[model samples]
Target chain A: MVLAFKNETFRDDFTFSNSPAAIRRFPFPFVEDKYMYSVNIEPHELGPKGSVYEFPIDIDEHYVSEMRDRALVLDADPGRCQALPHMITAQWDMLELLMTSMARDYPEHFSLTRDGNQWHWINRPLGIDHKFTFGDVATLPYQPMEYIGRQCQGDFSIQDQRDGQLWMDAGIITTQADWSLDFDVGMNFFEWHAPVPLAHQAGVFDRALKFLLNMQHGRPVRRLNWTMTINSRLDTSPENYHKWGIDRTTVTPENVGDKVHLRVELQALWRLPRSNAILFSIRCYMIKMRELATVPKWGRRLPRVLRTLPDEIADYKGLTRYRQTTIDWLSKYDDGAPTSLGGGPD
Target chain B: MSTIKSRPIYPGLSPDPNARRNVVVCDAAGAEAVVELLARADGEFAGRTSVVLSSEGLFGKESESIVERLKPATVETTAGLVPAIDRLKEILASATMGLRLYAAGSEPLIGSVVQAGAENFIDPLSVRTEHRGSLKRRVQCVHCKGMTENVTTNPVKCAQCGLLLLVRDHYSKRLAAFQGVCINAETPDESPELKVEFQ
Candidate 1:
């Protein structure tokens, strides 16, 4: 079914909000009351009809607006989307994966017709219908990855697997939580995640890297990562942190419900068929504190997750300034009840 | 916790006897490390070695005195680290098989050599590094993307954008510098006291 794409802004006035349907499918990351680092991964298989995992490439109400914000970010800093010279083959692999998945899942909104090397793609929401030679970069308006990545909802990265490591060779990362793809473009999996506390000591990367290295062509894996943002701002990137960081101070007891947002990332990884590379898609979903409290389980669990959150992690996530305010606001919805087994709305 | 994994570590220089050629790049303070490294080397090492020294910083006189004692086949002295790196790049371009690369002195010097080696198809981790002299850093401002060299303070002011940046240990080998983010972005007026942590 076609989604009612929202005409919202992620910046300036910050008009972004989630509908009731959208909030129900929100990927609430905390499964239990307390949270800690883990290699929490699962197969990227189809889930129940209305869940975010219903499709390989999820397109929601925010798709149009998110894509627009991505364009604005790229316009301001072209460095946000980058691919090394060697990632050309992987770029085509990414285009094929996204196009086929999106078209198959949401046939109403997207269509892809392939006639050998010549391919025709129509994105109804964005109002684009283009025909191009599949493997040729000259036939497309932009590079293969950028052309398709701009159309997709999430931040996409392609990792070149070599020397028993995944290299962050290419990505379009406009909506990253705090990391900079420009700074981390060529870093290996371990190197790029160096800043994260406790996880390294926990051998999380070692196990995760081993798992990813052995990932096969048809199989894809998924995980959930989260961070908090002051507003419903999509570009919480370090590149523009100076502009948005001050929003942390704006949060108070009164405005916490409207101001604070829980940003969750549905990170999915696929092993590309052609390039032997991995396609890492990070789909960001943001819901305000007030909207999230509508779901009783989420409202209760989020506060517990925040209150008992490790000091190191809390600092690392940049929640030191406004965590107490957000927790105190969210606490009103919590009756100190135990959450259910999984991260689903009760 | 202060040591980040991405930040390159100096394992101290050791002579590679199996190498057909040896290229040693260093700054003024690194001359002692070179001397210490050469003390353990065999006589044949001196014959095959080419040394690039930059006597520009505070330890210049000490570096010269130490350089005088070296008996390598060739010694090339430059005005500073930038020129020394340029000379290293020239050598790397013409480098043949069985070449061993070693870098010493300030982190910037070592990082530049490693970066240049990486651009020339040499693995950065393969380059031997030894830290010496000033602990000052070379920071890249995340805002303006400017490279501020010789940053000594924790909340150092960006050389280009003038933003007070928190010098994070999170480093980038490709850029050969540490990441500097705006420290006072949340509360612009309240400035934190600058600490000379790096030096």
Candidate 2:
């Protein structure tokens, strides 16, 4: 598919918005009228054409702008992209995964040509064509992971599997949801997720860890996780909480439709062939409440889901202040009507 | 939710009789724990043990008394926790097999000792730890990534960024500090009431 990439900004005078087509393929997270924590993982198999899951790596209209935002973030805070010394091999593994998937899935926008260890890659959208040795870091302009991660559309983390646990050894996370990659760099699965409430007692991590540990090469899995962002802002990191947290307070019934955004993460994990590490990709999709309400089924279902959300969850997702206002606004579209079963617009 | 999964749990110290060399790292308030650990050991354990004591704030006299009572093979005393950890690192540098590391002190001291051990290729979970002193915490500001030591309040101010932060039990062994995030970020002017929860 040839995508007419949008020119937008995710910060300061936020001009980011979703087109009608973008909203249709937004990866709406709710499968029902209510929501709660669950393992919700599924095989990352190809979905219906034009859907987000149609390809392993989904690059949409936001690709160029998102990459630009990532570059701006890296220029300001280079620590956002870090890799431990031992994760060098895993870095190359991730580079290969992203390059191959992109070149194969979107042939027009990207291409990869290989001659033994020397490889050539062309990213037409970003206007880059480079040739370098695959295994050699000195041959590339940046480290393998950062080089490829800069071009990718989502936050990528590599988890080194050892001691029967997955350690978050390397990542390039600029558009995170209130988490700091610097603080969480060396943490294991359970340790990084320690701040989340209620999921631990439900044995969510325990089950999820077991499932990821045995992940085989060429067989990846995916799940959807979500939170509400006050704007179309992407860099909602804890490092900038003092700057953007104030947006939550600014939400009112008057501006709830334009300001409130449902941020959904399409999290996928693939076991790397060489490093025995898992590549975790978090592709964020943001749609404002106004754009989401265009879909009849989603407009009816979202308010019901928010109204029944547990207090602990609402607080944890940082939606306590704006949730009621957004729900009240969305309730106008919910005519006490029955919606479809799955997370699809009808 | 009573205990955070990432928060390290100190399984109170127990002497390892089979170890050829024993190293004990402690703060002033942890002297009692060291004394009890040595007392419980069988067969001349103190003869092969070395102690690193940090008598930083209070309990100076108590630390001196414990040193006099438990006359281990060698005792190195420092004015603060930083120097004690440096001494511990030097000792670990020359360490061989059959070495058992024991840390008994405030969470910061113990966590630092464990972190130093980890840098020397020793597994942190293998280090014996006993919480003995003040419940004061060491917190890392999630914003500026600056660490503030000896935090005694819940909603403490970040020493670097000046943001009033809520100290969370979510901890990092690698960083050896609890995570601190802005408390009233949304409503910046409204600061929550401070509580001496850590103390």
Q: How far is A182's C-alpha from truth in model 2 (Å)?
A: 1.2
- Candidate 1, residues A262-315, lDDT tens digits: the string is 999999999999999999999999999999999999999999999999999999
Candidate 2 local lDDT, A1-346, one digit each (tens) = 8999999999998999998889988899999999999999999999989999999999999999999999999998999999999999999999999999999999999999999999999999999999999999999999999999999999999999999999999999999998889988989999999989999999999999999999999999999999999878999999899889998889888999889999999999999999999999999999999999999999999999999999999999999988888989999999998988999898
User: Candidate 1: DockQ?
Assistant: 0.84
True contacts kept of 2: 0.73
Error of 1 at A58 (Å): 0.2
Query: What's chain A's TM-score in each predicted model?
Result: 0.99, 0.99
Q: Which candidate has the highest DockQ of all?
A: 1
What is residue A310's positional error in candidate 1, in angstroms? 1.2
Candidate whose TM-score is highest: 2
Clash pairs for candidate 2: none
